[model samples]
Target: MDKSHQTKAFRRERVRVGVVGVGGFGRSHLGAVESLASAGRAHLVAVADPFREQHVELDSRLSAQGVAWHSTLEEMLEKETLDAITIATPVPLHFGMTRRAVEKGVFVYLEKPPVPLLSQLDEMIAWDEDFRVAVGFQLIYSEPIRFLKQAILDGKLGTVRSIRGGAAAPRRQSYYNRASWAGRMSINGEPVFDGPMTNALAHVLQNILFLGGGDAWSFARPTSLRGELYRCYPVESFDTSCVRGVLDTGVEFAFAGSHAVRDESPHTLEVVGTRGTLRLTGGTFSSDIPGLELPQHAGSDVPMLASVSRFMDYVCGQPETDIIRLEDTRGFVETTNGTLVSSRGIFPLDARFVESYQVEGDPGLDVLGLGDLITQTITTGRLFSENSAPWANRTPTVTREEIQSAVLEEWIFGAEENPKNATACL
Candidate 1:
C-alpha cells in the first residue's frame, strides 16, 4: 500500500475496541465512548451482551450507529480482531477474558477487581508491558483525587498521620434482582462480594494509598472494625458494613457501606497529617494544609473513564506521566486486601476482637478479582468465577515481601516517581 493509503488505513482502523456486558454500567461505558469516539477520541467498534433483546436502546443504537454487536464475549473475541477490549462482563469472566486478550497481545481496560488473586495479578503483570493492562481503580483518575495525590506528594500535609474515609451509598434489592450475580458469593463459579472495600469503595482506598503514602504504601496493616455488618442475599456475601482500620504508617482509615440503604450519601474522606488535613467529597480534592481547593464539580465522572483513558494513552505509548502504573495499584490493592481482613476480624488493628468472633472459612478472594467478579456475578449468573480464598479465616497479614512487590510494580508504573518528575519512575 502507498504511504497515503496506509495512513488512511491507520485512520480507518484506529484502535478497534470491544465492550462486554451492556447493563447500566455497560450502558455508561458505551455513552462515554460515544462522546469521545464521535469527536475522534475513540472508536466504538463493537459491544457484547447476552440480553441484547432486553436493551432496546443499546441494541438500536449500536445497530444504527453501524457498530457491530455480539451476544456473548467469546463470540466478540473470536469474530472481531480488536486492538483492545473494555470488559463490562461479570467478574468471573474477567480473568479468562483479560488473560485471553493480553495473551493475544490485545490491550485490556478491565473494570475494577482486576482478578483478586495476587498470583493471577502477578502473572498478568508478567505480560509484555507492550500489551498494556489498565484496571478501573479510578480514584487515581478522578480530577480531584489526582489533585489530592499531588498534594500528598508535595508534602504539604507533612508525614501522613492517618486516613479516615467512608462511602455511605444505598442499593436496593432491585440492584441484585436485576442481575443474576448480584449479592452472591459467586456467580457461575466465581466468588462475589469483592466487598465494599474492593468494589464501591475501591476508588476511595486507591486514592488514600496513592496520595497519602507517596507511592510507597505497599506496607499494609488492618486495624479494626465496628457496626451493622451483614452479608445479604446471596447471604454468602457482605451486604452492609462499617469498619475501622489503620495503615502501616499508623494512618487510620474507616469504611461504611450498605446495600440496604434507600438513598446514597456522599462518599468522602479526610486525610490528616501532623501539619494539616486533606478532604475529598464526591471525588473533589481539597487540603487545609496545602491551602488549596480544586474547583469542585457538580458530579464525578464514572470511575471507568479515568482508567479507560489511561489504557488508551498507555496503548498509544503516551509519555510516562499519563500512565497509571501497576505499582500504584499495588498499594491500592494491598490497602484493599487489608480492609477486607480487618473488616472480617481476620486481621485486627485493635486485636480486641481477635478471638471474640469465629471467622468463617476462607473465601480467599482477591479483592480486585472479587470486585470484578461481584460486578460480573451481579450482572450475569454463569460468568466471572475464581476459586475461593481458603484462608479468609486464617488471619490477614501482609509480608514485607507483598508490600515490596506492590511498591516495586508501582515504581515501574511511575506511581512512585515524584508526581512532578515523571521521568524518574522505576
Candidate 2:
C-alpha cells in the first residue's frame, strides 16, 4: 500500500483512549497506552487524576505527550472526546467511575477487583452486555494460562478434583499509607476492604477460578465458604487470609494469602484431578500427567500490557471476542465476599507475633511463620481456624444469603455492619 493509504488505515483503526488516576498503578497503564499509541493501536488523548499535582513527573510527561489532563474523572469524561477510558482509581471509586464512563458510551479497562462490593460488580456485569468492558484480571490473557486452560478442556487433568493456591508477599507501610482508604475496612461508612485476597494474590485466585471451570468463559461460583481473617498490624482489614470452599460444580477450592510474610514466595496454584495434577507458579508449569510436556517460555506470565492492547483492539471492534470478561470475575468476587461474611470480624494478632521491619526507609510488618501458615493451609485444605491457630476464631457457617446480606449492608449502610473489632487490611 502507498504511504498515504497506510497512514489513513492506521488513523481509521486508532482508538481514542483516556486514563483516570495517572499516578502509581495508573502510571503503568499510561506506559502501556503510550506504547500502543506509538504503534498506532491507540491514541492516548487525555489523563485524569485528582492527585496529578502530586505527581509532577507524571504530569510533565503526559503534557510533553500532548495529552490533556483533568483533575477528576467526571471533568475528563465531560471535556475529553474519548472512545474508551482505563480506570486505575481506588477500589471504592471503581464502580461509580466506570459506570459513568460506560454510561457515556466509552469502553472501559478497569483495574483489579473491579469493585469492592458484589452488588457493584453485578451492576457492571449487567452493563457489560452493551459496553466493551475489561477487568484487570490480566493473567487470564497470558499465553501460559491460556495454554493451560486449553489443556484442561482437552481433559489433560481429567475430572478436576480440587484446587489449592497461595500468595505470601510482604508489603511496606508506604503501601497502606499511600491513600486515606488504603488498608481500610471502610471509609466514611463505605466498604474499602482491601487485603491479600482481593489485591496482592487476587490474580492467583482468579486464575484458580478460571482453571476450576476449565476456561475463561465458564468460571465457577463458590457454593459455600469458610475462612479466617487476621491483621497483625494496625489496619482495619486483614493482612492474612485463609479460605476453603466448594465450587457449585462440587470441586474444592482453598486459598491462603498474606501481606505479612517475611519473604515473597512464588504464588502457586495446584490443580488436582482424578488423572493427574498440575502446578503453576511464577510462570513455571509442572504436571504429573503421563506424556505431558511443559512449554518452554520466558518473560512475564502477568499479561497487563497485552491485556491493555487487546482491550483497545476490542474497543475498536477489531477483535470481536473479549479475552477477559467482567462476569467471569463474579465467582471470585462472591467467594471473597463470602469469606468476609463467614469470618467473625477481623482479628488483630497479639503484638508478640508481629515483628517490625524497614524497607527502603519505609516501615512494614512481618508475621512470624506467615509463610508456614499459608503453606499449611494450602496443604491441609483448611483455613487458619481449621488448623487450630491460637489467634484464630472459629469460622462461622456462612450461607450465600449471608454473603448477600454483607454486600447489601455495604450497599445500603456503606460500612461493615459490625466493625468494632475489625482489623484494617491491604
Candidate 3:
C-alpha cells in the first residue's frame, strides 16, 4: 500500500463511542471522549444519564455536535451502534450498565473501584469473556507510574522491601450530602462501601498493590489484612482508615487516608528497597537512584485522558497494551473487602477527639492530630493502632478467603447496630 492509502486506512479506523453518566467525574469522561472525537480518533455517538436534562448547556453543546442524549443506558444502547462505551455511573449501577454493554458485544471503559463487592466484580469478569472491559485506574497509565513499575521490575530499586502510601483530604458535610449513597456502607440493599480506602483515595491503594506485584502488569493479591475504620463525620461508612497487609508475594504494605483532616496533603507513595527508596507525590517522583527521570507525553499529562486514548486505540484495532483489565483488579477488591472484615465494622470516633469547623462556608470536622497520625503511619509502615492513637482500635487480621465468604449485612448491621443510628462515640 502507498502512503496515501495507509493514511486513508488510519483515518477510517475511528471508534464510535458513548458515555454513561455526566455529573461529577462523568464530566471528565465526556471531555476525554470529545477531545478524542476532535482528533478524529473517535466519534462521540451519545450519552446517557438519569438526570440528563439538568445540564442544559452541556446537553445543548453535545446535541449541536450531533450527539444524542438519553434518559437511560438501555435507550442509548438500543439506538446507537457503538464500538465502545465508557461507564461512569455510581458504584451500585456499574455492574448492571456493564452487563448491558457486554451483552451487546461492546467494549467498556469502566470507572475505578469498578464494583463495591468482590462477587459483583467476579460476575463482571465472568461475563467479559473477550477481555473487552478496561477498569479505569487512570494512574496506571501515567508515565511516572509506568517508569516506576519498570524500574522496580528492572532491579533499579534493588530488592523490593515494603510499600506505604496515604492521603489526608478533608470533606465537608455537603460532600457527603451531595448524594444518597455517599459515605454509606449500603444503600437500598446494594453494597456501596463508599469510603477513603475504596472510593476517594482508592487509586493510591490500587497503585501500591500494582507496584508490589511480581510482574509489570499484575497487582499483588492480599493474603491477609489488618485495619482500623473510623468516622468523625455523621456517615454510615468511615471517613478515615489505616490498613496494613501482606501481599501474595510476601511484601508488606501499609496505607492511611482520611476525610477528617484539617488540611489537605498530596497523595504520596513510598517504595523502600534494600538499596534505595522511591517516592511519588501527585505527578512527580523523587528517588535515590542516580539520574532517574520520568518520560513525557506528547499530549496531555492528565492520566484520565491518557487512559481514554489508550483504550480507544485498542478499540481501533491497535495491539493490546498492558492496560488494566477486570482480572487485574481482583487483588484490589479483595483488599477492600478484607479491610472491612478486619475492622469488624466502622467505629465512630469519640466526639471529644473531633472538632467542628467551617471551610469555605461548608461544615467539616477535623480529627485531633490526625494529620500527624497519617504521616506516622505512612512513614513507619504502621497502622494507627500500632502508633498508639488514643482512639484507635486494635482489630484482628482477616484472610482473603474470610472476606470472600463474608456477608455484607453482617458487616453493616451485625451484632452492633448501624453506628449512624446512634450517637457518635467509641
**How many collisions per candidate?**
26, 7, 0
Tell me the spans in candidate 3 whose CA falls farther than 4 Å from its real position: 1-12, 289-300, 412-417, 421-426
TM-score of each: 0.70, 0.89, 0.92
lDDT of 3 by residue, 1-426 (tens): 011212222223688999999998999999999889889889999999989668999989988989999999999999998988998888878888899998888889999889988889889888777777889999887776777788889888888889899999888889998988898777767778888999999998999999999986779988998989888788888899999988998888999999988799888888888878888776567778776665544214688989999888766655446568888899999888888888888888877788788867888888888998998878898998899898899999888888888876677534225656223331
lDDT of 2 at 312: 78
RMSD of 2: 5.3
**Candidate 1 on 133-236: residue-level lDDT in tens?**
66766556656665666666677678776665555454543455666655444555554444565566666556555554536223243333222234422334
**Model 1: how far residue 104 lies from native, Å:** 1.4
Off by over 4 Å in 2: 1-12, 127-129, 298-302, 407-426
- How do all the candidates rank in terms of TM-score, highest first? 3, 2, 1
Name the lDDT of candidate 3: 0.83
Whole-model alpha-carbon lDDT for candidate 1: 0.52
Better of 2 and 3 by lDDT: 3
lDDT of 1 at 146: 57
Cα lDDT, all candidates: 0.52, 0.77, 0.83
Point to the candidate with the largest TM-score: 3
